[model samples]
Target chain A: MGKNVLLVDDSKTMRIIIGRSLRQAGIDFDNIFEAADGIEALEVLEKETVDIVLSDINMPNMDGISFLREKSTRDAIKDIPVLMISTETGDDIIGEAKSLGAVGAIKKPFTPDKVNEVLGPLL
Target chain B: MEIQDKMIDATKEIFSTMIMMEINLEEITDVHGPLTDTITAMIGLAGKRKGVLAVHFPYPVALAITSSFLMMDVEEMNDDVHDAMGEIANMLGGNIKTILSENGRDIDLSMPSTIAGSEYSFQSDKDVEKVIISFSTEKGSFMVEMDLEK
Candidate 1:
């Protein structure tokens, strides 16, 4: 048993890859949960306690940005550290994610080792 | 005109450089039917150029490719590997978008979509000036389709 992590993304494929990366990285997390979009993620929070959130920035309905925006206002979800992962590497998006309280940001096409680098200290 | 060519080239480079694979279309007469073992990554090209850029690959090859790229062993193709296929497509589209500005084309991109099923044809609506570049790995068996519309 290790820390609990909430993985958010619209693609199941990506979740698997990221999950594999986490395991390969040896983050030692227990009860890995996943949400297709922010709306579902919010729902997961109601009953589950996640130590960290590894999320993608783009999604349908409630995207990563909107999720962060809304989550910032919620006292319960706000304190939980979020790591933004997506293909968009624009400075503006990074700035925005940082402002929204993302503990870290990693670009897409990322290796599992990169996941470790981002989550090592925090999680 | 060059922007389109450049985008095509970018895709070719990715498959060759990252996957250690190359694709060709000289004998691809029927680009239809089922590619059951195919791995695909699809991403949207928005803004001035709006459409989707997808990478089509054979299943094991995709798993093999991503596995090698990530340094992991994916015995069975799962949702995560499939999603990585899509993200790879997204990355190809995103990088090409960067070069569009120089050619006077402004574009916004959307997330990628990855699909792994059997027997499907990915045909583009527009055929006029429509571009489709193919790449094949030196030792791998598959093709990458860059179906982009301007």
Candidate 2:
């Protein structure tokens, strides 16, 4: 069965592009939820069952790192894997995401192949 | 790699992968005159390097990119076009920031802003190092300018 996925990003265009790339990567999802930021993503989680999350690091009103930290403390959603997608190449940022229970990270301007490579085993 | 090369590569990659537009570097030149009938997006960077990165698109080029990005025909440069342009700048600036930070420069990017008009002009501060590069696609041409105070 396809997994349920949640996409969090402030940019509408980026959400669409990431959705397209996910499909192109052959990672089918039973349900794909979209949120403008981490705050909205938590709202989505309140009502939906998400098996994985793909989020961008920078956003207004709750960024991805904060979301990961929040998700890490929640028993209901803590097990669901989170993958960060951002243009941030800082080692410290990536390390922080990893410590917060992010399964992996994907840099921006990612191709379908790169997406598949990072998410294939996890999904 | 040099900063200019990194910016060029980031622009090419983002346009090609995200927007599905094949863009080639045309030339790297000095800052130009006022851009009429254009849309511009700017994002600021702070920390180890303080600067602003701006992307300027002619109306036709902006329309084409907006259409491709939203998967609809954008005849007029409206809010959607403005948002699309801003997102493009954010991605471009974000990628450039990552490249710089990886090479030993720490930088933080600010939220992007977009403006669409025909009569405005863009000028950088005198102390900043300005690098302007022009890129061409089949649809039209645009420029990416980076002004950094390192």
Candidate 3:
């Protein structure tokens, strides 16, 4: 079966840009899902069969750290790898994310080449 | 390099990598006049360093940036423009935070917000050390201003 990816961000513009970057990087997916925040992301993960998640750290309703904490407790979605695409590149924050099961991260203001460099290995 | 130089580099990188537009540094100043027919997006920095990062864009430049961002033609100021501008400020704010704080735990960044008007003033009532860097794009020019508490 083909892999699917989910994008979680509050900004519609960012979601569109990420999707565009994925296409520009020649990373095609059978399905691409989206959510506005961690709560919506969790809901999508529960309902959809997603291979990976690309999320933003700062968001309304539920932020990325809280989302990781919440997702870790659920067995059904616990194993799904998440790669962060955010402006938050702080060691403390990224370290916390890695501790919570995030596979890796891509900083904001990144190029398609950067996206490919970071996300290619996981795929 | 000074904070001003870092800000300039960050702004250029954002424009070049994400917006697919090359921007040249116009000037660096501590103050600017009132804005007209422009949109401003800002993000707050709290915790160890209290300040705000703002980006001011004229209507044409903003529309062009938004258009380039989405790879579509944008002729009007809409939610997409606001969101795109806000995200730019967010990214800049994150970069500023990295510059200000080494570990990133000492500071916190507020969600990005925006204000647009035909005419208005952007100033700080509190004492601040301000640095405003202006840049020019093919469409027009814009400014990135940072106000840190003194």
Candidate 4:
């Protein structure tokens, strides 16, 4: 069975690109959910059975770091792995995301091979 | 690698890897002129280094790139074009940010903003170090400018 995945990003274009790349990477998902920001992402988590979250770091309502922090505190979603997919390139930010319970991080303009390599073990 | 080289590499990689478009370096110019009938996307950088990065695209180029990125035929400047431009700027700025970080400069990237118009010019602070690199592909041509307020 495939895992259920949630994708969070403010840009609709980016979401579509990421979805295409995910399929190209051969990461099959039972169900794929989309959210525009952290707040919306939390709402989706409330109703869906998601196994993994792929999120962008910068968003309007709530950013990825804040979402990860919130996710870490909730028992229902705490165990689900969060992987940041963003254009942020600071070690400080990446470290902070990890501390907040993010399993991994992928920079923008990412290739399908790189996505698969980073997410294969976690999913 | 030099800053200009880094920027060029980022642009090439993003276009080819993310958008599946092949791009070639056309030239690097120091000329500053008003961009008419063009779209420009900008991203701010802060922390150890502070500045802005802007990518300028002629209308045809912007439409072509946006269409390829969205997997649709974009006829005019619309929401998809704006979003794609912002994302492209973000990706380019993000890669450049990583190179700076590796060199021991801690930097933070801001969300991108885009502007489109028939006539307009950008004026930066006098203290900034500005570098502009131009590129072309079968689809069209564009320029990427890095303005660092040192």
Task: Give every prediction's interface RMSD.
Answer: 5.0, 2.4, 0.6, 2.4
Q: Give every collision pair in model 4.
A: none
lDDT of 3 at B79: 97
lDDT for each residue of candidate 1 in B43-126, tens digit (9 for 90 to 100):
777677666666777777777766765667777788657766776787677566666533323566776777777667666776
Tens-digit lDDT string for candidate 3 (A47-97): 999999999999988999999999999999999999999999999999999
Q: Estimate each model's TM-score.
A: 0.71, 0.94, 0.99, 0.94
Off by over 4 Å in 4: B102-105
Ranking by lDDT: 3, 4, 2, 1
> Chain A of candidate 1: what's the TM-score?
0.95
Over B1-150, each residue of candidate 3 has an lDDT whose tens digit, in order, gives 899999998998898899989899999999999999999999999999999999999999999999999999999999999999999999999999999998989999999999999999999999999999999988889999999999
The top-ranked prediction according to TM-score is 3
Q: What is the lDDT, from 0 to 100, of the residue A17 in candidate 4?
A: 89
Instruction: Evaluate all candidate structures by whole-model CA lDDT and list the values in order.
Output: 0.71, 0.87, 0.96, 0.88
Better of 3 and 4 by TM-score: 3
Compared with the true structure, what per-residue lDDT tens digits does model 1 show for residues A50-122? 9999888778889888888888998877888889877666666767888998888877666667888888989
DockQ of candidate 2, scored on C-alphas against the true complex (2 decimals): 0.53
**Chain B, per-candidate TM-score:** 0.73, 0.93, 0.99, 0.93
Q: Per model, how much of the real contact set is kept? A: 0.32, 0.44, 0.86, 0.68
